[model samples]
Target: MEESDALRAARAVRRSVLGDAYVDGQSADPDPAGREFQDYITSTAWGVWARGGALASRDRSLLVLAMTAALGRMEEFRVHAGSALRAGVTDEEIDELLFQIAAYCGVPAGVAARRVVRAVRAERGEA
Candidate 1:
């Protein structure tokens, strides 16, 4: 399939933030619908939010994590939190972010965010 400019840019940004292994894994799913959904995100979420504007990838990643936590979206939180690390956010910063969420967005949300953060940290051998 021919890749659009947006898809190309998004893929670059996504890989930079999530690593080539994770990005390739996303593309490895054999289902057409899954591939299509990934493509759509490449053209939208990563293409626009991740690749555009003045916000550095690290800052954008942190913001995305905070937003996902505030909205109680654990799955998205997991993805972005992992990506945040790849995007150069440190564990301490993530901790601060979750603490901020607990203070403002509520304890449950912060707790949920912590679970995902720990899982990702463990995956990276930071446990």
Candidate 2:
């Protein structure tokens, strides 16, 4: 892909994964190593991730939430999981995703997700 394509892909990941909390619009660093890693994340990973594949945006977001939850990164989950809902992912879908994570992301992660999901839902009157 082109450099512009790389940049666009990275931004999409940032917007969808990071929501409004990310303010680092520029590249990570000027060093070659940082550029290489960014390339890998933008071109190789995110690029190859959806190439010729067709999942709805909500599905993709759900997958991301599950993975992040598995890592026990509660802060990240609280945001992106809300983003996933905003992207049209349903509470049921998120619940299922969290269930899957519990099998892999552990009970604590799923439990934490439940609390967050509940709070966000309440904020939207979905509680």
Candidate 3:
């Protein structure tokens, strides 16, 4: 199937925030179902990212981190933590966000998010 303009814009936004390597890794190879899921996320979630609303990309990155952490989606939290750094979210801001997560989402969720953020920072040599 041909890629739609929305998909193209979504991909550009996703790549800009997440980096080409990560986005390409996600696109590598997949069964039909997986491909469809990928396309859905690219066109939906990333499409919103492409829209450039009042929130800047950095703001959106932080929001994703917080939401994923609150939901206990540690893998996704890890992924977004790296992207958040790339998008200009400072480590201090992330640390503060973790505190907010602890207050609202519970201590365990905050601890899990901190672990993911630490791992992400270590991978980037920022720790």
Best candidate, lDDT-wise?
Answer: 3
Residue 13: error of model 3 in Å? 0.8
| TM-score (C-alpha, index-matched) for candidate 1 | 0.87
Superposed Cα RMSD, model 3: 1.4
lDDT of 3 by residue, 1-127 (tens): 3599979999898998889999989987668877888889899999988887798888989889889988889988888888886788988999999999999999999999988888888887876
| Candidate 1 vs candidate 3, TM-score winner | 3
**How displaced is residue 7 in candidate 2, in Å?**
1.1
List TM-score per model, in order.
0.87, 0.63, 0.92
Clashing pairs in 3: none
lDDT (10s digit) by residue, model 2, range 1-127: 2477656765576555445454254345678887667566666545543453687666667877887788777886887776776567877888788788878867888898888888878887876
**Across residues 75-118, which tens digit of lDDT does each residue of candidate 1 receive?**
98998887776788888999999899999899999999999999
> Between candidates 2 and 3, which one is better according to TM-score?
3
TM-score between model 2 and native: 0.63
Worst 10 residues of 1 by lDDT: 44-53
Cα lDDT for residue 59, candidate 1: 87
